[model samples]
Target: MTAELILKLAGGVPAAFAACLGFGIVFNLRGKTLVFASIGGALGWLVYLLASGFAGDLQRYLLATVAITIYAEIMARVQKTPVTAYLVVSLLPLVPGGGIYYTMRYFVSGDTGMFIETGLHTLAIAGALAAGILPVSSLVRLYGQFKKHRLAVN
Candidate 1:
């Protein structure tokens, strides 16, 4: 809402987009699929940025990952591709790159206290992201089962 917030979000957009697109390429996504996956990543980062103001670090990752997973699953269904394609790419943006870096940095600097703290925090964020993905994935599988059953009946 504020100009500063908008500017920050704007700055993040390209990083998110690039991270997703690069991952998409690495994952061999082509054409519209790559674009859609990239959009998912950017949108996820934007949500993370907006929500960070209100949520703690773990919560931010959880919320962002949930949104990206949902987007990836829907896009997968529509695009006739495996959810992994989009999910992997979309999640690249939300990966705790900084956390990992700082954790390792502290460890190498012999700051065992800071290293332990940062390492635990990074692990927690990773856990939160994984937790976010599990439910949506299960829901998608359940939906697929129900749809298959209905189709078989009719």
Candidate 2:
């Protein structure tokens, strides 16, 4: 890989590590919990890259959502806390804040064409992420239900 790519990867790693660590500490994670969260974040980034490689921007976002959601669910199970806490950090990278900002800037400047384009792009990204996560969330719920059913039968 080129130096730029290496730098980008490195930048992502530390940001993810710090985000995960912060989330873990805030949520009272102990022992190996911090390590796990950091690992999850790193792995999530890798998943994002892999998914992005095989698809377009929207599909990439969707794949990232699926990866992050799975990571959050697994972390919740391990940490014995709600998934929201970890998810908050896990989704830091995927947010469309920059897109929204640019869109608004273009709108304020009366650049209707650019504004519309940016807005549409932002919505498409959001839609892809939502679409990707919905299935994972549904699967998790279904798995939980199956576990419950098994327990009830026994």
Candidate 3:
């Protein structure tokens, strides 16, 4: 059991690392090789694992939000770029496009219950993502301010 657990945890790192590398490449393609791309990828995988373990859309959404916010702040600082770039890419994994599509299809096929549930889940994910990011961004900004002040004082 311990070995299995260790294997799972070990498996996650390479997946996360590759994801981060891919994100980094894409972000770099845009002339911004901010470290946040890698950070966002790692955070996204971590959130996905944790959220999946919880077996709920809300948890996934919240995790995605947190990941996005952290990446956004880091990108802003490292690349001296706008937060939107980081925000957009970081959110790519959690957008629930598949959910939305299935929900619409179900509705067209006259499955109201599935449609409603899926729709709700989709909305919850969206809400959670938004909720998770706001506070984190504020905190990052605060930290940045503190660092700036300390540097100036020195």
Candidate 4:
């Protein structure tokens, strides 16, 4: 809400967007699909920043992943594309790149204590991200099934 926060978000969002855009390109997404994928990443980062104040890192990543996954699902349906196309790019912003790096760094540096701690932290964050996506995707699948059953009945 403050100007400082707004500026920070402005700076971060474009980085998130670019990260998604870059990954989308790597994954062979093009045109409008790539744009939407970038938007998803930016939106997820915004959500993470907003929720970070209220929760720890794991919780923040979980919240952001859930939001982006839902957005990706909706976009996929509207665009008649696979959800993975969008979800994969969107998740770029939320991935624990730093955690993974630090975990490896600690291990290579021969710091067993830090390595174990960082490794566990990275795993927990990764799990949280997965936990966020599973429920929403399942619900979407369930809704599709119910719809199919209803239409079949008709």
Candidate 5:
């Protein structure tokens, strides 16, 4: 996209990294696991930014989630650890916390329109995140099973 978009996304990368790193530390992730999980957050944000150039917010989130899930799966496989640890930490940047806050704010202020709008948007984000995770995770499991079956046959 434009240089402005690139610059903004670039700026966001470090923030995403820092946020994930903080959460990873809180989750008791240490050493390389923590570092790679943080990097996965940065990578997810970068993918979201790049996808934002051509996609709607939901699409961007979906694509970014896909990217992060793939990264988490790969990293988990390489590190021989559970994928949930990396996936959860890496997805912190995209969790739509602000949407939920504003939805609540609107509800409290008696603004039904904004409340409904923001609430729906927030729900959509949660749905998109779940939808994004499902396919990648299922495929990974299926692939693992297939490989195992092949190994057993041989």
Candidate 6:
């Protein structure tokens, strides 16, 4: 990576953290929960930045989503709370808000081609998020179920 890109990524991680912290506050989170959730957002950004070297935009989104989801799952258990708090806040950095905005902008300007491209890209981002979350969540649930069944049998 170029020195400038590295500097931007460094700056971005903290910005992502601050943004998530603000969102967490809006979500009524406080103390350690807020801090950890914010860190998760920074982690997502860091992963995305790192992946930029060898991955496509969609791949970066997928990697970032996976990192954030895993973080949320772990943090939820660690904090003895629901995953929504961490997952929602942490994922703010990776959400396709810009894509959606640009898509709408193109639509409003009668640029059908750009609108179609951005809309499809936005959909693919959503798909990547879902693809990252589903398998990990399924595995976690399956592990919990199998453990519970084994204990009951014992």
Using lDDT as the measure, the top candidate is: 5
lDDT of 1 by residue, 62-154 (tens): 999999999988898899998988888888878878999999999999999999999998899899999999999999899989999999999
lDDT of each: 0.91, 0.76, 0.71, 0.92, 0.94, 0.92
The residue-level lDDT of candidate 3 at 39 comes to: 59
The alpha-carbon deviation from the true structure for residue 1 of candidate 6, after best TM-score superposition, in angstroms, is: 4.3
Model 5, residue 115: displacement in angstroms? 0.8
lDDT of 2 at 98: 94
Q: Candidate 4 lDDT, tens digit per residue, 1-154? A: 6787788798999999998998888889989999999999999999998885678878899999999989999999999999998988999888888999999999999999999999999899899999999999999999999999999999
* Index of the highest-TM-score prediction: 6
Worst 10 residues of 6 by lDDT: 130-139
Whose TM-score is higher: candidate 4's or candidate 6's? 6
lDDT of 3 by residue, 27-60 (tens): 6636444445555756776666656655575776
In candidate 3, which residue pairs get closer than 3 Å at backbone N, Cα or C atoms, i.e. clash? Answer: none
Query: What's the count of clashing pairs in each model shown?
Result: 0, 0, 0, 0, 0, 0
Tens digit per residue, CA lDDT, model 5, 13-119: 99999999999999999899999999999999999988876899899999999999999999999999999989999999999999999999999999999999999
How much is 150 displaced in model 1, in angstroms? 4.6
Could you tell me how far off, in angstroms, the CA of residue 41 lies in candidate 4 after the best superposition? 0.2
Ranking by TM-score: 6, 5, 4, 1, 2, 3
Q: Candidate 3 regions off by >4 Å?
A: 1-29, 34-39, 51-57, 141-154
- Give the root-mean-square deviation of each candidate in angstroms: 1.8, 3.0, 4.5, 1.3, 1.2, 1.1
Give stretches of model 2 more than 4 Å off: 1-4, 19-39
